[model samples]
Target: MNGPAQLADLLGMASVQRAGVALLVGSVGLPVIGVVIVGLDIIPVRFAMMHVALLGAAIGMLTGLDPALCGLVACAVAGAGISPLARTPESLSGAMGLLMSLAIAAALLVLSIAGVNASAAFSLLWGSILAVRVQDVLVLAALAVVVPALFWWRRRDLALLLHDRELALVSGVPVRRLTLVLLVLVAVAVAGGIRLTGALLVDALTLLPALAARRLGHSLTAIICWAIGIGITVNLIGFLVALALDLPPGPVLVLAAGAAALAAHLIPERRNTSWHASVH
Candidate 1:
């Protein structure tokens, strides 16, 4: 069959449809969350949550429970536990490092004790979009709505907080409480992204687009719009290209996002340099 036919057949499968919806939701939601994450300089928290999710998945495998649910709960707990430490960049970094180490070690211990197959463990790390369940799609869909709604509702506070936490606090923005809420939201979102794209490449949907959009946009709102637009574009292209090439979508998606970020970074520099030379 031709590539389009093959893609159509794949899309016809219920599982693939679920996977596509999950990705679509993620493409929209993750970037909005990424704005807060990038603004607050809390990138380490996402990495820590990824490891916690893996530990949760390991425990689920041992206990015969749904790994996705276990992972989500684990991430939420970790996010809450670490919220107090988010008072400063240094504390947050140190706490995240400690959490990552502990989570990964615990995950290894659980896997070894249970004699879980390496492939099963590896699945949590690499993810398989084709294996996405309906529940996963629903969770992503809900988050897609809730996160953007929260951002819209709290736009003023978030804007102030992102600009400068101390300034936000001075303006009576309830920095600590808002930070805690954002962290929890980020944790849950990261877990959902992991379910679709795996721990290692969730950033393709989350961070990379935000980073690329930053290059293209000057204001917070503009950056967010660009991030969402970039995320949707890359995700769709990557999914279709993966279908065409008979490849895994996760890595291809990452590559596409990375390429977009690279172009976003370099193109502006080249344009500026050309402009400078012409002026000189």
Candidate 2:
């Protein structure tokens, strides 16, 4: 058939509908968390949580439990456990590096010992958007709403915290508790993203949009708004394009996000170069 007819038929599938819902929620939510991550300079935590999620998925597969639940739990625990080290960027990086190594090593061991099928393990690595379920959509939807609401409610405090930890503490921002809470939230968000897009490409939904938004926006609220807008645009375009081309949505989405981010970065530089030449 025709391209539009083929896409319509694909969209008619329940699995595709569920995947679309999950993607929609992710496109809206992950970027908000990304702002906090980037502001806190906790980028490494995302990589560490991804590995932890993989390990959790491995154990879940070995024991016949829900991999997503296991991964979320693992991430929460890791988040709380590592929160104490978040006082400094250097310490956070070191701790996250150690956690990433341990998590990957343990995941490999579990997969090897259980002799899990390569496809099963690969699913954890790359995700299967078409296989997303109703429960997954509900979980993602709830997180999408709750995370943004929390960020909005705490916007002022978070702004202070992002500005300076010492100033936030002096301003009674509950730095320790806030840091712990944010880390756990970040962990849960990462786990959710991984369930939909996999570890390798979760950043497409989370970081890239926020990074692009950062380049375009001068304030936290502006950054978040820009990120959400970019996220929705890229995700919808990528999902539809993938459907049209019979390609995997996850990688296509990543490429779309990357292209947007690259454009966001380069366009301003080009403008600045042109202005400089005009001035000279």
> Each model's TM-score, in the order given?
0.90, 0.89
- Give the Cα error of residue 132 in candidate 2, in Å: 1.3
Worst 10 residues of 2 by lDDT: 271-280
Please report the candidate that would top TM-score against the real structure.
Answer: 1
Report lDDT (CA) for all predictions: 0.83, 0.82
In model 1, which range of ten residues has the least summed lDDT?
Answer: 271-280
Q: Over the stretch 52-81, how does candidate 2's per-residue lDDT look in tens digits?
A: 988888889899998878888899899899
lDDT digits (tens) for residues 1-280 of candidate 1: 2377777898898888787788898888898788778888888877899889889989999999988799899998898888899888678779889999999999999999989884686577667788888888888888888887777677778777877777778889988898888888888988888887888888888999998987886556667789999999999899888877888888999999999999999864422221112211
